[model samples]
Target: FRFFRWVWRVTYLTTFGVLGFTAYSIWEARNPADQLEVDQSKKTLVILGTGWGSVSLLKNLDTENYNVIVISPRNYFLFTPLLPSCTTGTIEHRSIMEPIRNILRHKKRAVRFYEAEATKIDYEKKIIYAKDDSDVKGDTMETEVPFDMLVVGVGAENATFGIPGVREHACFLKEVGDAQKIRKQIMDCVETATFKDQSQDEIKRLLHMVVVGGGPTGVEFAGELQDFFQEDLLKWVPQIKDDFHVTLVEALPNVLPMFSKQLIDYTESSFKEEHIEIRTKTMVKNVTDKFIEAEISKPDGTKAIEKIPYGLLVWATGNALRPVVKDLMSQISAQKNARRGLEVNEYLVVNGTENIWAVGDCAVANYAPTAQVAAQEGAFLARLFNTMAKTDAIETEMRELSAKQSSAKAEERTAILNEITERQKQLRRVKQIGPFQYSHQGSLAYIGAEKAVADVSWFSGNIASGGTMTYLFWKSAYLSMCFSTRNRVLVAFDWLKAKFFGRDVSRE
Candidate 1:
């Protein structure tokens, strides 16, 4: 009886504590402290994009060091890794998006945010021209923002490789709208396939889904689509289930080229089990509204042209430099030879530019354009800025002390000299910041049918794992990596809802 009473008391206390914390968090979010007024003397730090790179920098940056302004077309940071799940309704799009305002509110000082696209940068003048592209705008639609230091993290765009009809007929999975469009298209195709008096040939074509590229994004999307077919679509539209087909076409020799050979083999086998066809060494020459023309190479180095019909085509070939990035490159002589993106120095400073730095897909630092790399680079930049700010302060103090020492009495002069010596040491320590370095955290991917693969860096070695256990690891890792508790909770609930009730088949 005593033990039962103790358990009840503990439960009640725990519940109350949780409720109190929740209430406090809500209140704090609603009532943020007024931001410190911008100090005119401080340097203005302008950041572009709200992607992994920019967000990471904002999260770690000391706002007191600079007056920060963020400019991006998007006002929310997307969790790109889970974007594939959104295509099949396994995870809702909103679940993975954390508003930029929500993130900025937690900072010690308020940051200026502009939901506008950076049209051009006047490097010599240290000014950026941004335009409001929204539907409704005020009298001032375009303005010039002056920055003392600028960070360009405007990520890349979808690469179509100049394939014919790709832009008009194919869907690129890069943003929330893309995922929502894919989901709607999938259902539309399924519904059309189920129309009365529909011929078998047309039905077959309508139920066929084709994905271009063999990278992680393409593979993951294929997996999620297959899962949707097997889980929700099969139960909801069983008539077209047997005719559904998914094909992944890659020009390379194999899928998941970045992954280990063993893991790649495992993923292929898993995909085969899920009835997802993988066609390697098949270069797509053209894409039409109804079908795609491809050249399939034989083992004997012979190639045969073939036309394949698809109901829905997802173009995930890769990334390309955005026009803004290309324009910036053209303006900088040192970046003229940069084919992929802007070339940067060891510290991520744009070549031939002292005040401009770049990160993420916009920067060509000889690193793979991955979220992990961008995030690490952002954090490194934050630390570098902090250190630089400290060095500046120390140097200012040292100069003042030196001047005071020259004008002071003997005793005061001795004391000022000692302080100057200490300040010099501090400045030296602050200036010793090394160049940006990246530590690979390894790779992870999900290949349907309750399976996943991971090649993670362990203590002094590598741990390659796959199967259901690895799927759990993948889920936990992504959940923990979510940008905020709100996002994490939403994602968790979505997963649980999908698992329990299955993904919603009702198209919006």
Candidate 2:
């Protein structure tokens, strides 16, 4: 027994030794401490915003060649396409957003991410003035971050058209806060309308929801609001039976100016059938605390003034250039004539600026401010950066080779040098590629529950699908488009839960 015990002890020690040695090997190979070192020699590529464009670029960038620093007020990349669903709790906000840190995992090197808003750009100094909001209240504590190359992906802000009282009285659906506020405000309106002491007129006005703008966002929100009333609210609190109403007002002749004529027609018909009123060609000229003064223009150039009363007003009237962007545009001579956004060249580089790039909604790419375009631009910039890095690497390799070829045979050296020259030329060619081009995958919009319209490229389609099957397709398509599979699963689960059980009405 003693002999067996001795053998067992020896075996255990050997096993432990092997395990320790293996771990040491891994530690040496990985060089954990070395990985943490920020590469100062490499070009510092500082990118603003954690939106679709910036995230895509970061994901595709060759981390080894650049010391990448990402700055944004928010650390997570929001899936904007699924954002409309968040208003009605169809998909939880967290489920749609992918943390920026997780996305940077694709990189070979560590990326420095800062949660801040860029205040100003110093072109001469090659530094950006930014405000870190980690500890501050409403104000931003400022600092400077120097960059060798910069990418401005800061997105646009919602445009309220400077209508009186619109900013204060209406809720704009742009960010997560807006969606959350809208959700809470909706419940508040419902609850206020349900008050026992409230008069019929007060209740009627409170229940009369007004959505200004016939864009996809406004239409989607209107549809979701209608669905909430029909599916959940009516069943749960039948008391507000005839109280709830949804009105969509657009200045244009039709809603969804971007979509096909058939889709717009379908949307109109769908909203009408669901008892949602659509007041097209009605421009809201002035907005009071409780009512909107609109100018209804006739086709023959005649215009009539009308007033619309409402408890809750949702403004989804597209986007305007952000103040910071506009300020930057004004300072630059190249951007002097630019009004909307930063004018960028074919390489996605801001015009008249060397080593500066802009992407997403902040870029005047002549594309809609959609996730698809932003992501595409980001990917393109990533490739551009990668190519630039490759060109640098090739140049370095050629220099080293040239040094070594000093004592070699002239003919052999020339042949080898020629090969290096050819490779450098190829790399340069890749780096010189033109600005980004956007590929349209077509549009998709959810009109209501169990009904959707997709102008997809499949089968050369201008296809508009409605009813239960279309809903399934819509859900599936959106789920697949989610940033991560985990997100997809979570969104799917949310939909299933909503289908099986009604939406949660508690304020919390």
Candidate 3:
């Protein structure tokens, strides 16, 4: 009886403690403390884009050091890892997005943000030309913003490889809008196939979903689609189940090139069990509204042209250079040989420009353009900028002390000299920051049927895992990495909502 009573008491206390802490966290996030005004006398530091790299930098940076201004067409930082789930309504789009204004409000100093696209970057003039391309037109649509220091994190766009009709027909899976479109298209295809007097041939075409690429995005989306088909679509609309099918077309020999070979084999086998067809060694040559033209390589090395019809097509090949990034590269003579993205030095500084630095997918740093790489790069830059600011402050203080020593008494002069010496040592230590170094964490990708694969760095070596346990680990890792307490809570609720109530099947 005594032990049971103690257990109940402990549980009661723990429940209240958690509730109290959660309430406080919510209150604090909603009500930010006073912020210091932006001082124009300080160096103007400008950041572009609200993606992983830029957001990570802002979160770690001491905003009080500089007059900071951020410009991006997007006003929110998107957690892109779970973007595939959005396509099937497993996760809501807004749950993974944290508003830029909310993030800036919690900073120590005031930060300026503009919902405008950076049209042109003038390196010589140290100016960025921005234009507001939102729905509503403002009186002053375009303006020039000058900065003493700039960080480019605008990221990249989808690569089509000059395929005909791809841009017009295929849906991408990058942004929130893309996911919404895919979700709507899935429902549209289902409803259209179930229409009265719909021919069996047309039903088969409308129920077939095609995904191009073997990367994480394509694999994850395919998994989510299969889950939807099994869990919801078949139960809700039975007639189309017989005709429904999904095919993944990859130009590579196999999918998920980033994972271990064992895990790759596991994924392929898992997709087979889920009845998702994988067409490897197949190159898509053309795309139309209803079908795609592909060249399939035979076992004997010959190729055969085939037309694969698809109701909904998703293209997720890889990233490509944005026009803004390309224009900036063209202006720099040193970037003439660069093709993929901007060439950066060891410190991630753009070549041929001292004041400009780049991170994320836009910068060529001999690393894969994953969110992990971008976040790490952003944190490195934050530390670098903070050290630079400290160095400048130390130099200024030394100058003032030296001037004061000249007019001080003999006794005061000794103390002033001692302080100056200490300041000099501090300056040396602050300026000794090392070059940017990337640390590779592992990779994770979700397959269908509540299973995921992980290639994690453990101790001194690697550990590859694939199954239900890895799926739980994946969810926890992503949840803990959310931008704020609010985002994490919302994502948790979204997952539970989908599990208990099933994802909303309504077309949006």
> Scored by CA lDDT, what does every candidate get?
0.92, 0.85, 0.94
- Overall local distance difference test of candidate 1: 0.92
Query: Residue-wise lDDT of candidate 1 within 1-508, one digit each (tens)?
Result: 9999999999999999988986786678668787776665789999999999999999999888798999999999999999999999899999999999988877877789999999998898999999999889999999999999999999999999888899999999999999999999999999999999999999999999999999999999999999999988999888886899999999999999989999999999899888999999999999999999999999999999999999999999889999888888888898878999989999999998999999998899999999999999999999998898898888888888888888899978778888888888878888999999999999999888878899999988998888999999999999989887678878999999999999999879
Which candidate would rank higher by lDDT, 2 or 3?
A: 3
Candidate 2 residue lDDT tens string, 1-508: 9999999999999999978875675454335342445687898999999998998898788888889899899989898877877887877888888888777654678899888888888887888998876765555377799999999999999898788888889998888888898888888889998988999988988888999999989988999889988998898789888989999999999998988788789889988899999999999999888888999988899999998889889999988988778877877799998877999987888988887899999999788888889999999998988988887887788888777678678778987778778877777686676767888887888888568877776655556555567767877888778886557767888988888987887665
Winner on lDDT (1 vs 3): 3
lDDT of 2: 0.85
Question: Which structure among the candidates has the greatest lDDT?
Answer: 3
Q: Candidate 1: where are CA atoms >4 Å away?
A: 1-31
> Candidate 3, which ten residues in sequence have the lowest lDDT sum?
499-508
Instruction: In model 2, state the lDDT of residue 484.
Output: 67
TM-score, every prediction: 0.95, 0.89, 0.97
Task: Kindly report which residue stretches of model 2 are placed more than 4 angstroms away from their true locations once superposed.
Answer: 1-36, 134-140, 298-301, 409-415, 418-422, 425-435, 458-467
